[model samples]
Target: MIYVTGERVQAYQVRSAFFDTRWRGLDPAQVHDYLCRVADEMDRLHRELTTARTESERVRQALRQWQSRHNGCRRRGHDD
Candidate 1:
């Protein structure tokens, strides 16, 4: 009786979920459609998060480069 928690509901799990049919269970078609949508949204969010992380690293590297250059200039100016 696996449950669908937020952390456990990845795209793979959502696509592969198999609920046993019963006399009073929800329609499988509706469940599958909704799960597919959830999986799609999760994929979109993951891609966005990865893109943001990559961009953030690039910004940090640029900032470090600028700071190093600025510090070197300051040291040279003080020598005069």
Candidate 2:
């Protein structure tokens, strides 16, 4: 029985492939395939992280702008 965790699944899968290759003396073609798959996964994860960070920053900026406006409105009421 194999239990997998989300964070380690990709690493585990790659390691498992390498271990199998070593045991069976797999050819270069199979090794290349595994490496390519790992690279593609890394690229996808990178893009996702970048997109999430960008969205978070935009939200933060918007919140700051709204807070500034709200403060200004409150000050105006106090002056009147």
- Alpha carbon lDDT of each predicted model: 0.84, 0.70
Ten-residue region with minimum lDDT total, candidate 1:
1-10
What local lDDT score does residue 2 receive in model 2, on the 0 to 100 scale?
Answer: 59
Best by lDDT: 1
lDDT of 1 at 80: 20
Residues 1-80 of candidate 2 have per-residue lDDT tens digits of 25566654454345455434466586878776777788678768978988999999999999998887787777678531
Off by over 4 Å in 1: 1-9, 76-80
The TM-score values for the models, in the order shown, are 0.77, 0.57
Query: What digit string (tens of lDDT, one per residue) describes model 1 on residues 1-80?
Result: 37756655567777788888999999999999998998899899888989999999999999998887787777678532
Q: Give the count of colliding residue pairs in each prediction.
A: 0, 0
Pairs that collide, model 1: none
Q: Residue 36 of model 1: what lDDT?
A: 91
**Model 2 misplaced stretches (Cα beyond 4 Å):** 1-24, 72-80
Residue 78 lDDT in candidate 1? 55
